[model samples]
Target: MRTILFAALSAAVSTSALAQAEDPNLWLEDIEGQRAIAQVKQWNAATEASLTTMPGFEERRARALKLLNDPNQIATPDEVMGDLVANHWVDADHKRGLWRVSPLSAYLAGKPVWRTLIDVDALGKAEGKSWVWHGANCLPPEYQRCLVSLSPGGSDADVVREFDLAAGKFVEGGFTVPESKNSVTWADRDTLLVAMAEGEGTVTRSGYARIVKEWKRGTPWSAATKVAEASESDIGISPFAVMDGDIRRVAISRNVGFYAARVSMRAPDGHWVELPIPETAIFDAVVSGQAIARLVESLGQLKPGSVVAFDIAQMLSGQKPEPALVMEPTKSQAIEEVAATDNVLWVKALDDVSGKLFALRRQPDGSWSSKAMPLLDHSTVHIAGTADKQDIAFAAVEGMLSPTTLMSVDSTGKAATIQALPAQFDASKFSVDQRFATSKDGTRVPYFLVRRKGDSRPTGALIHAYGGFRAAQTPTYLTAQPYRSGPLGLFWVEQGGAFVLANIRGGGEYGPAWHQAALREKRQNSFDDLEAVARDLIRTGVARKDGVAISGRSNGGVLVGAAMTQHPELYSAVIAGSPLLDMKRYSHLLAGASWVDEYGDPDKPGDWAFLSNYSPYQNVRPGVRYPPTFFYLSTKDDRVHPGHARKMAARLSADGNRIYFHEYMEGGHSVGADRSEDAMRAALLWAFLTKEIGSGAD
Candidate 1:
């Protein structure tokens, strides 16, 4: 049956003979199939044996472990629940994590008397499940009750259980959602707006909850009242509740596309009222009584990337509220995050790829006043958590050379450091420099370089980028992962190697225009931009011509995959992790349907025309001298199917190309579930890089 299905899928992939070629490794897509698991184990063993045998591999692994297990690292607040700040902490002792909380006042001081609410490792042992902490949605006001989400094996699908925060225990006979990619929001003390995987017709094609029900206390899930439903073709529906001072408003966001959603609020009469706004407009947060939304497309007189505030009272009254612009970024600016406190809206943005924060407040006469937040210069500021009842927020500020420092901020924009992480690496010995590379379209692509001070000679370097999904690659501490953050100083830079962060097109660094430049048929621009950065690194004496490597995961994985296939001569090594390689079959895979808005649908003729051109799997040639590539993927990665890495690796090896494949059994889309696993992967990556490019100083 599986074989017949596989053959049918192959035939339906494309009408063209090239794409109609039968896939020999289709069985690998079965995920949990015995054959697939055996093959993954064999590859894992081979890759581990080969990489771990390298000189200094154990030492590097130990160093990474020490850094990852550092107890002095700041426990950044994940959320503010009433007067307590909640943080999920993971260390050598608590590998899974400890969902703990501390008084905001005590946390603001240097010492925090943390009370562990959920010991994830202990819970996992008690339940005999490898549970990973998803997060907790605590009820506002007193915040005594919370819905705790726990994922088995680190997959996106998780089981939700209600917990009593005051008692630090799971509430008996309380609400519980079965394992699925579900969402549960507290509508009141005894009511919940939940989107769960009940049975057939409950989940969308993208494997998310398509129906949302209002579940009440002491009742079966089936007895819950249906409040909202989205079409199966839609991405999914998520119910969210916002607390506006003393009032609570419930809304359902029907995600029609990845970046598009239609939000409707439940009126007092129990009818859903759709908000009169563009589907592309992001409903950021509700501050006071105003709904804040960030425009992705031009709406009326407001331009794209404009943050606007709308009065909620007018919308609830069946009237279209005129949006007042809170702030509009310049051409060189990009809004990163929009967070709200009780009375203030904090906009974290980037100016020419440098971090800048602003505080906007709605004034009398329906006007808005904005003021730049007093933050450290040349550092990235991320809002850790924001208080709902108080005009207080916490942000973590860090840079390429600076360790992360947690700060508490007031409505007046005054920020005071709460805790600072000790330097994990010798940052004083390194310097960060921003450079520009002219791309094929005459566009200037900005990239950051982290290298030893006073070193100008060509050396081995790694160019990292994620040029999709409007995600901006920002500067972080050395202990940060390079896949998301810009660089890894301890593993690469501290080892006398230069690390390059390519802020190419398709990223939010420069705003929506920057990302749109690399969309659809223009996706090649991201590849061109990446290659230009690699060449620029060589031309500027930052990296040896034959020693540059490129690495990215997921979207960035597609970037490097295209880079190696399109411009193989520019890079010596390529590391693609959990990538989307077979564009022809991506949409048919799990959750791939939701991303068609980002990457064009391959089933469509015109879209496939462009996707096929740069698809690494389809573009592979018999005799081309491609760079040595390493492919790592998680078997539990239900998001970006592991088949992408499997088939790509299989195809490359079949073509007699040098390739290494490692498929981890756990850690759905991420490197691992714990810090130790993350450290091991980092060490393995460094081993491969060093082996390919020769230890830094040439």
Candidate 2:
């Protein structure tokens, strides 16, 4: 039976892939595969009458299908870009407002520009439109703003907009160039470092790129010249600068394990000097005087086990100084964030087991003193943190039951509230708890479980997990609170339902080490961690296996997909949003090549063997009893190709599984159609969850 089912699904997928061949892009092919899969699943379902259906399932599914198909539900390219900027940033200023960028465009006098701006105040309240601000640097003065103005409508060309806060309006100053392919950072008001693709290759194969050229402020549009190039096999140019008294030294980083090259002014001429640091996937670095501090993940290693501060100042002066290991790895702790000022090295140690934050300061004598800071234990989760010599500011999200607050701690050991949500949000009835589940490896993963206070009915549960990319899934006090509160009147809480956030291994919650445990070759560790969490909940009688539902987006979508395929018995329903199902082709897809360091290059012989072991799309078996699932993808998602979700759903549906597929034509990577449309999507999702997980509206 399983063989028969598999054959049918494969046949459908092949037909769909062929239909989509009109678009040569791999994305079109994936979409076609999805259509075929859906057809197969539907045919199979027609033959099976034993599949259970929830009350109002057909009606709710119809409504969802209609909302997804409605033209008004789709977001324009501009709206999609705005959502991307808003959710991508963790800094205080970036999180507080709604951000929008014009579609990609070019200015004739200026360089190809993408108008990137943010309105500092509009979030959550507005449907589609948020607060708006033109080109301006949010950071303090002396920082250069690399602004791009997108041409009206979606265009390939853009006018690079350079704005000096000191002078105001967008100026025609600076060199012109094609649209950027990588992130651009500003160094001072005059120089800009942009990432340009110099080469390409297959998804799992290696490639090359150069970081050459520095666009100096006031320089003519045509004068851009090569400043540096990445070595062969290295694909990125990370631009950084260090300020020392009156001089500024520019640094360029390259390779899989980012090695540093320092360019400093030496009287008549400046020369480039390479710094010595072990080969590792360096995320970021800070250079000051003779000291170079970096956050590095050792090559082929999971966690950034060492925080090294090397004295390259003496090296620049023709002397060699030994590098100091400022912070060494502990059993379960890894460096989360680090900064150096004066002579002290301030580091944040993320304790994996407790999901707690620890502050460690290296004194002038090089001794480390560590203290545990109060966990921002509200419904609002911690998004990002910034630190300097005198103080540190961390942004956190409280749930819809609580206001999002930005808190700070000064050198004086005094903690102060810097900012709070401006809109009135009620947080009286909800409570949040951070708990741990033991994974198969004996690794305890932390999770934040939230529900209404005094609601102990042991009702259904919604378990969410995103354990990839070393991204931390913190708490947020937003619409989730209201949704959990029985807003649709489904009343999961009233039914005694609870929400569980599984902090599986592949996340930053436990610092880099936690992420390393689940990356690439050890990818199965994440799945094991997630499965353990589900079992723990069941074993503890907190929630029954049949009463639970799972949801995730992007990498999290991969998590859900894996769960559905591998352990369908654990969940009654699954929602995979904007998921990357075809791991085999992920790296070759849009912007996927850049993530090789995270997911491993699929092209390599060794890596391919490991990646294929869990490639969700390739591993889907025929005739397997999978849970009912709702799949969503956006047509405008230029990031993770929507074909993953579309094809996966189609395949499952065609295989006779209860599946619902919704494709939003214009929502980009984040699947919300528009402002109002997004809210409606949220409503539909909640509605689907309640119908699937909640008991009748008693």
Candidate 3:
């Protein structure tokens, strides 16, 4: 199964061969090899022993677990399934989480009667597998029949099983696809569109499905008809369906690169009609017969920051549809989200790092009109869910200090609070402020600073950032772990330390221009921006120069690793989780080849020249004194290989630098499989931070 998926990867390039020949720690890249597993287990034991004995470890763990398992935590709606709304719930009772549904009418009336559809913990117990819920793709109209995805060991590769909602169980011998990093879309009642690792030449070099097939019910997997096929070098290809009142179009999306895609709609004559969309633009969902797209570069009359739409009917008939302007943001703004609900389009935009929501509708004159929806000012707003046939949508709003509140918005832009979470942490004693830090190149970067009110003394600070990817860093209330924006916020701030969220370059905080400024060759700007934030904190008296710590995960892991190696004295400690460290061998790792557009191809000499400078695995000097670092990883993380953290930790330890390494057995890329594990990781992190820099409770 794995061989067919990664067969094409080994033939890639000359840079990998050279790097492998030079690196002595390549043995740790063997992921499941006996020797590598033994090393990881030993390191995990030592790290746990060292961190668990820190001051207030058990107390902090218990407190974190309590907040994480709080029964009153907000239950954010996952999807609008006909008359019922689905949600994946986690708590002390349901540790593995539960895929359940509540009546939509009752949910809107503030009295939801939930019914359990899938108890993940029970299912795992019965099957003796570490199953993680990966959501469902239910057929539209009735939403009774669905394709449920469950990932074993919480990895991205998941098994798709056809489920019967009315029967409350998996269909006996129904449509089922084996585990792989794949996609299954509902084409109709008896037919489905799937893209999975089937056989040799079917999977891309990036370990994704290169071919999309149409599979009919009661047919063998071999009998599926080919819908579309992308190049083996491209990222991958997947099929999706767009359904409005009378508009239903099934399209295949060919991901040419990490930041680019080519979309083609299937015509009634069984031919693919390609859309004239630029690769840089994102092909969003079609709503009310309009195929919407967000531009990353200027397209004809549409600006880089504009949202454009095309008539799906015109495109299907082999006619080039005139681009219709949906919404255009200012230089200070970025389009955060664009969701559709049949007749209504819900857009969430960020202005100066603060969120604002708008409800857009297609006027009778073939143009779009938008109305500003009232929400919490200076807070983060996200589209929680949108009904398939209704004109209403759900928005989750929260801030650095404010608890999260779920709001319901109607077609006319009227908003109402559906449910509000009670304060889990004492925000009254703390204050939130937005500040700007100037980078080395004089670029103004924005960040959110949270600290105790009236406390001006220098204290230990934790600065978190993800400077790669166009993902924007927004503010959220100090909530539970697993949530990216404000993970462990309460745990850190309650210790009397200031919590800082640095909105550095290489992010969509401003727009495409901001992210493009830090692309591959100019990636140093992101690290410089991070360093500037640390200096700004010290200069503003918010933190002691020697008491500042940097934390990031995944792409941010790259940031943390780069920061510590590039400027050892700037940060007191580092928390790097599930990172990509060996830039030279990154493309050869699982799913790493797909991210070449974001980080650049290490195979190319020109790309490697710039990559070699910041690549943490290559840049770490043996005698250079570095800050104490905590490196966490998951053996099941197929996206960003565990070898990254493993090799980096081994190298740092061999060099006599303080390194704490922990590799979780499950949890894929997230590092925490469930709430219990999330709480434990948070506790361990805070314990390590408290040891490195005094917990500012003095």
Candidate 4:
């Protein structure tokens, strides 16, 4: 009977071939799916109608995109490093910051070596020029050399110019190609393997989806020969080594689903052999000689969070393959980090409830060790590891306060502190605590509370969360300092205020199980979880409901919109940033199709039944007393369309609700006007929140 029910659901929700080919949400074919599409169309029409005549709206948006695409506006290597150091590591002892855009620089003998960079900022702002850095092979090397991709500033062309880092001069042996290229890895001193997107007309129908193209180290810039072409949905390179001579094996995914297959290259004619996995659904895979490790999901199980291992040599050599489930699917064992070394594959697994590191180890014969790393008592753990499998680092440990400590455990079992914040912000007076509350179904949810010590006043509190996409809302020192130093100090704590980080169910904080529990038809779980956090804060007397303001970006924006409609009396103000409010048309919208895995397909009937019930745009009825809200979006948001925000604001405004809409003409998906622009926006958000939530006046 259960099987029959699942089959019925699957059939009803399955997408059409044409839809699947054009839209990522092809799996959602039920009645709810149709409604979702209809709602999106309605929202788009409303948004276009409202903004068509707005003075400079179109121009501003175009200007923003141009700025983003302008090479001069891009951050230099030094600027990128400084930003990372400033925002990521706030500790007084360490000098390193969180590495963004560029992955961790490759290190040899305890020194920095090579690094890669993309021209896009963390907020998806275009840097204009893309580049990579290669350093001396010497011990404790000097990284004074760089190869920069330089095209005419605003032209959408691909050109690379090699620059001598020390002399600040461009070398004559530079190259240019027709297609933009990235993910360049040095095979030898003279050979490069890069990921390229070529022959682009419409990527969905284009023959070149994503391919690995090789380049000779000293060769002039010319058309690249495709090493491998990926299917439309499947993308990602296998974690393999180029160290042992040739490119031994490559991992490729044929479908958008989470499954990967290995293609190995052997000598004696150099033919590529493909080993297919019939039963496993893998998202990522890494190969280390004879051993292969992969992140696998159980068939038909929404929350099969596990990592499996196989003997690569045995599989490729046509021997009886010994497939072992390296990491078993645990409700609590959420895989946070995984990497491959010469002989060992390292895995970092976390337990959901305590935000604690459960285990870190190398696969096969390596020992599994467990330690409770001291995290900021209220911050979520965000872990990042090196590409070469030598170091493992984590940011935003609870209780540290001011800045995050970049602590790395080396291959020799030695833990060293690499980087931290400079001594600018004081960390002595703050305190954070974790609290839990019971949801509507009696499910216990957790949230983080942060405030200054020695304050007992009924301060204003800002409760924030992003309860979708299995994206965890972890604690970090970046945004907290602004609040802590300003309104947070003057209003929340000094003037008596508080800050809350809600760990709602839709987030991966609790693992894939936590996310699956809150998906599709059960989407209400996220709302309930968030409400539970709010109630817990109120019950604890941390802040009254009327003094609380809720803020979230992207999918979290959807949460804010839904909350305002469902329980308007809970929050005094709502700040929805780049939200997808018109859920009915989310799949049909930009980048909306990619999110069907998180949110059920709206075109399908069964999905529609559940989606329409809580879709914030659909739920907004006439004559309801809604809380004052702020809507912010970007005109160049190629990911989540700005229409979501525009339409929501129009409907609310027409209905006589107080809604402040600020559409950034540029800045891509982030809507950050610039560094200075972001500062002003932050100030506005604080001021608005303070005024609405009754924070201490300046």
The prediction achieving the highest lDDT against the true structure is: 3
Give per-candidate clash totals: 0, 60, 0, 42
**TM-score list, all predictions:** 0.96, 0.72, 0.96, 0.69
Worst 10 residues of 4 by lDDT: 1-10
For residues 1-698, write the lDDT of model 1, one tens digit per residue: 00000000111123355543567667677777798788888878878888899998888788777777889878988887777989999889999999999997788776889999989999999999999998888887888899999989988778899999999999998888988777788888999998876557876766677898898899887799988999988888888887666667888898887888898987787788998877888888888688888898898889999888877778878999888888999998998888887778888899988888787788888788888878888888888777666687788899888888888887787888899887766777889988899999899999888888888778899888899988888877756758622224457877788888889898899888888988888999999999999989888888899999998989888898989998888889998888888887888877787778888999899999999999878888888888889888787777888888887887788778778777778888875777777777887788888878876766
lDDT of predicted model 3: 0.84
Q: Write the candidate numbers in order of decreasing lDDT.
A: 3, 1, 2, 4
Residue 75 miss distance in model 4 (angstroms):
15
Clashing pairs in 3: none
lDDT of 4 by residue, 565-584 (tens): 99988877888887888788
Candidate 4 lDDT at 448 equals: 69
Instruction: Name the 10 consecutive residues with the lowest summed lDDT in model 3.
Output: 1-10
Pairs that clash in candidate 1:
none
Which runs in model 1 stand beyond 4 Å of their true positions? 1-21, 484-489
The lDDT of each candidate is 0.82, 0.52, 0.84, 0.51
Q: Which is the better candidate, 3 or 4, if ranked by TM-score?
A: 3
Candidate 4: lDDT of 645? 77
Worst 10 residues of 2 by lDDT: 1-10
Angstrom error of the Cα, residue 274, model 3: value is 1.1
Task: Point to the candidate with the largest TM-score.
Answer: 3
Residue 517 of model 4, lDDT score: 79
Error in Å for residue 12 of model 1? 14
> Residue 497 lDDT in model 4?
70
